[model samples]
Target: MAKYVLRLFDDRIGVKAQGSLPAENRIIFIADGSATVSAGGGAATLAANSAFFSAAETTVTGGAEGAYVLRYELVSVPETEHGMLTGENIFSELLLNASMELEPGDGYLMRCDRVDLPPGGIAYTHTHQGGGIRCLLRGEFHVQTQGKEHVINPGEPWFEAGPDPVLAWAPDHKPGHFSRVMILPRALKGKSSISYVNAEDAGKPKLQRYTIFADEFIAI
Candidate 1:
């Protein structure tokens, strides 16, 4: 089995850091209070609804005041940075497994999934292939993809498909914690072409985010 080094504070408290990973991955939230990040311009305050993304580098401070965050690096099974499904690093608290699809298909297709976390349970820094749809059945969190973030509260559906992963993010988990994502395998189509039908320019990733596909409003 995979074991986490447990290097940082897993509970609610406070911490500081030097901005690192670029491309929107780190997520900060107001747990019981709030927090602020001191940057080149000024300090950005994070309250209950105010969250921060850590895709790029930026100086950050106290999660005190009520702000807290979970690096997808820390919350996963173990070595989630590598992005492998069959490994000991995957967390049971946030279980991710592959189940055979119910319909016609050759081999096996797997979807990214999440179980339940504790009070402060969170999932962060994930990637989705082109033409991917992420569904948050229960719970609340911001879905960060394509260099932007979308606050996906309970009963919301988000879709994205591109040559590269659109990017995936969410706050944390509580009761009935779960998430379901459907992605078409590259092997299915053979070639490595990933694109959205609504792309304004060929190979350009769209920025107009929506909670439903086309016109389908997913229910909570």
Candidate 2:
């Protein structure tokens, strides 16, 4: 088995500026504006809300107006760089890091998706088959897990270790939306990752909707 760390980064590139992304298996999501990513002798333009994956060192050049992006990386060692801003007007923040183990010959998939909940919507107690990092994109929600509770707001990120029971709910007056990148079994590709912990909850009305952005098999 090989141990790995999954990290999420929030980045901003100034107009006409360029930045280098460390070589790793990574998924980059353009949150705002546009940018051009070059890797492996190829370049692609990523507009807002679009994402792409790269397994090698890559360079990103900001568009005429600059860009804001979220990057998720899987690496073999822990990262120590924590600088917030550099001279190039680039800003980077480390949001979350979780350790995991991968077995040889096992199939795995990397998925990025958005979940939306209407006002007062609730995701009853449930468990997932794999773990990943999630970032709240809009509104607010409350999470209960491991005997503790947390109120999550926009821009806040959290990690969910697979198999831990979780219960989340949005406020009665506001809706909640979030984006996440998860590492799951290849068998779950294009399928739901959630499983209700209680039988009764399974029969309840499910109020959350999902929008998948990227789902791809990953080499382990």
Candidate 1 lDDT over 1-220, as tens digits, reads 2222111111233433223232222333333345565533556766643444333444444444522332221222333443211212212121222221122332212233333434443333333342333334456655456678776655444454434334333343443233333334434333322343334443443322222111111110
Q: Model 2 off-target regions past 4 Å?
A: 78-87
TM-scores of the candidates are 0.28, 0.91
In the range 60-134, model 2's lDDT, one tens digit per residue, is: 888888988888887765454442334397888888878988764548888998889999999999999998988
lDDT of candidate 2 at residue 74, scale 0 to 100: 71
- Tell me which residue pairs clash in candidate 2: none
- Give the alpha-carbon lDDT of every model: 0.35, 0.84
Model 2 earns a TM-score of 0.91
Alpha-carbon deviation at 61 in model 2, angstroms: 1.8
After the best TM-score superposition of candidate 2, give how far the Cα of residue 117 lies from its true spot, in angstroms. 1.3
